[model samples]
Target chain A: MLRSPDLVGKSQDSLREAFGKSLILLAEDYPSLVVLDADVAGGTGVHHFRKNFPDRFIQCGIAEQNMISVAAGMAETGLIPIVTTFAVFLLRAYEQVRLSVAYSQMNVKLVGSHCGLDVGPDGGSAQCLEDIAAFRAIPNMSVIVPASPIEINQATRFIIEHKGPIYMRSGRSPLEECLDNSYKFEFGKGKYLSRGSDLTIISCGVCTGRSIQVVKDLKELDINVELINMSTIKPIDQKIIIESAKRTSKVVTVEDHSIIGGLGSAVAEVLSEYHPTPLKRIGVKDTFGESGEPDELACKYGIDQVSIKNTIINWLKNETKG
Target chain B: MTKSVKSNVNYIRSLIVSSIYHAGSGHPGGCLSCVDIVDYLYRYHMSYSFLDCDNVSRDRFIMSKGHCVPTIYAVFCDMEYISLSELKTLRKINSRLQGHSHRVAFPQVEVSTGSLAQGFSFAIGESLGLKLQGYSNNVYAMIGDGELQEGQIWEGAMFAAHHNLGNLCTIVDYNKMQSDDLNENIIKLEPLQNKWESFGWNVFNIDGHNPNQIREVFSAAMSKENQKPSVVIAHTIKGKGVSYMESIPSWHGSVKLTEEDCRKALKDLECTDNEIEVLMSA
Candidate 1:
């Protein structure tokens, strides 16, 4: 349990620092634990783990394919391995992750750092906007997107305890702290950040904080908005999503990923399959993002909080007209 | 711990031929080539418990050359992990014996192997995982010479050596044949031993059919430290036992067997009356 001081306070760096520290601490408890890095230690924030556990940390030196196989072999020997790399490199070993870790059901943790278009000015190639959808399609995989540093730390702890394989998404930019340390975090449950009846906004990662802001802004306009932070994408909080679609009759899904297969698509899957509601999907629409500031990209792509607010208002007006 | 070395290679040849003939649709060429090498590992120098296959610390074996699943399956069945009756169902639908194996189908299987080159990586991860957990168990991964054409296999090879994975052992079944042709005509891994050695492995070359030589090298590998992962370059002949099939690329995978062909292959092994009865029953 974390304290209020630990709440909504730390940046992504701080969260990753804490995660590295916690990982080193966990090494003491489980000596079988080993950390692997694919040349993104400082970027992914696992430098601390490398520093503290030099003997256990395997630096695979820029080779993503080898890193994946080595990690798989390590897992086969009964050790719990945590791998860190950029989203693009992780995709290089997608087949390895799928066949070896997921299909074989080995215990391995893959931390996809600098996910989405949050790598600031790194541009499209460096930014991993499609990672969420790419990993979500892996069967028998636990997909997690932590909203803030607090949630990142929580997800870190959660993944270590949970059995099987996991793909944890980490933000390149520091996100606002949303949950206090005392907040109870579970793997598959959606956090109902605020409650409203008129409309529901579902989001996760940095976009979750943005969705909360949209809820606040909509409230000022007398539009009672319900905001849900969906942390787990696969085995998504379907109950809340369907319930929200049923109550609000209109749902706005937001994420810093492609609308085709990311959070918006996941939410839409539930709605189309069971609850058919009018949905406004907020994401990068079938196009790669350009080199710009994280905020600029979000605003330009119409995934910012303001865009979410405007879309919800328009959807409401449209419903009334219909 | 186990030290298994065969004094004679003839026994393995006989067994491999008999098994492939019985199964009818196995990768006989590759399986024959790998038989002596695998036999050496199982018989000579690995510390794995046959009874406690589920032991977390027990040594693990992975067949990266998944098309040759029948070979390993036969070896395991001979070792009594499975019954002979189950051996008859190789490649049959709704059978534990799939063309590739899954642990869900068999308890002794640590990892499911069907897709090529991935098994080596899986073995590497599992090996490191065991070592990280403070377990002394080792992992043995086998890859086909042809399967090395897959990019991921090289990735696994490089990683294992770079990490100085001392408890890991990888064996290459250099039968020199691919699915449709010889490895040289395809993608040649000629400086194969040099490549592995360059990537920081303790490479050993052996006559793959000679079980004793394989056992001795594996034993040496087990005792060494401060070295990279070890690879035994087992020089083998594809379709080792049958006179006509040996070193033939077409036998890589096929159902070329008829009753007459099966009888001829079986006759070469000098099957006993009791063994003949067993085969008939199966």
Candidate 2:
């Protein structure tokens, strides 16, 4: 296990910035590494890569479908093309990603930034709560949601080295750094932050940070809860989840996505298939997200640290009483 | 055109007709319409060796209008990419030849593209990729007149031209007919040449069926001094050789061909009885 980074006094950083910086560093070693972006180069933070490596960077304008298919084509000729755009806009080219990238099994990395309700003020149209479900359904496609700037940077290096199709979702706002400098990202493994026997809190992406904070508070209250940061949603860490389910006999999944097919649904599928345990999935119900502050949206959507803490406390109390 | 090349085109047309007829389903009209252009590229223009399909610097062809891929399968069979016997197994259970192009099953296919307007973008990328690696090899992509209604085609046109991808060439099979009606009736693409020019491509218009015109336009597009992508607007009939299927919009997709219909189509292509027997047996 990697040592946890000190949470206090550490400035937050957006995952998009980390992704852009990582691409520039990755291009140093991988000569064939190329980055393609839609008109959202600035928004997705690939503008940093473009300024440094203009020869390797392609501004694909506002056309996501073309960017995706072009990335697939570049991949065909032994190039690693990382395509980026807003999460919601990426779905506009879903068929291109499905057929050209995923179906062909091309070595293309798709980075969808500004995912989930955290993309505040852009409202329901911009927030992509279903992206996780949409990408997970495609075969040969690996889905990863990095919880912090450090994790996103690690994921960028990992995906550049890994072959095949991958979709990594990142948030618009800066997130608290959760992983220490020593954390190594494995493709299908979840990082265990805290171990306890009473209950397991499975989470991913920005919610993982929030869940960890909540779990720390619960520990002081004598509520022993295990926190598992499940970054890889597809090909999920089934062993860790099954073991945790058997150990705790109870599980709760939190994500800044739709409850139907995001991390919660993924955990539920595993537990139900292997060792059935009492499970609770905390995420947005099937509904659109309205314009609001990112923090306000997180609380309203029931993925905030306070809501998670309350839900766990209530569930644990109910179980103990029964 | 040489007598042998003419004969090869006819053979490819026959293969397309027979395979679609045998399968009892497929887009025959578009397949027949685009056969000559595809044949011209594979026979005269493309640089891939018959034995080694993995040549990195070899010319790449993307069938953007992939539903009409029976024509490409016929050409591939002639090229010996796959056995001629496999043509009979098209769209069959566990067949390598899927209903649409399957890149996994057929490694020679650069990308699996049944979706319209997407393959053209892939070709643009391949051209860019080759260019970035300092390889001067060309990439050819074929699109249907009707498939131009898709917005992605214009997006690719803008990107390819903006990047000055001189090695990228697009052939629009301007067959006039689409799935349900003429392209004009579905969506007006008139002044199409100007639209491509405005999008920054070197546009060439030609009679799609004329072998000499096809060769000349391709040569001119390749040898042009301009550093822009080229799009050859090849005007073609919906169905070129077969009499009853030609220029008919309803024949855009599958039209059930009776045994007599197959016989007449083959006769129109001047297929010998022995050739017909071989195709039927396969």
Report the C-alpha lDDT of model 1 over B124-208, residue by residue, as the tens digit: 8777676656777778889999888887777777777766789888889888898999999997888898888888889889888
TM-score of each: 0.91, 0.96
Q: Which ten residues in a row have the lowest lDDT in candidate 2 chain A?
A: A1-10
Candidate 1 — which residues are off by over 4 angstroms? A1-18, A21-30, B1-25, B130-137, B254-260, B272-277, B280-282
Candidate 1 lDDT, A1-322, residue by residue in tens: 2233433226545445556655755667777677889778988777767776788888877778767766766665567789988888898888878877787677889988777777769888887888888889998888998787777777887888787889988767766676666766679988888888888888988888788788889899988888888999988988999987788888888888888888889998999999999888888888887799988988888888788778778878988899
Roughly what TM-score does model 2 have, to 2 decimal places? 0.96
Scored by lDDT, model 1 comes in at: 0.76
Scored by DockQ, the top model is 2
Error of 1 at A13 (Å): 4.3
lDDT for B75 in candidate 1 is 72
lDDT of 2 by residue, B178-242 (tens): 99998888888998999999999999999999989999999899874659999999999887888
Tell me the TM-score that candidate 1 gets on chain A alone.
Answer: 0.93
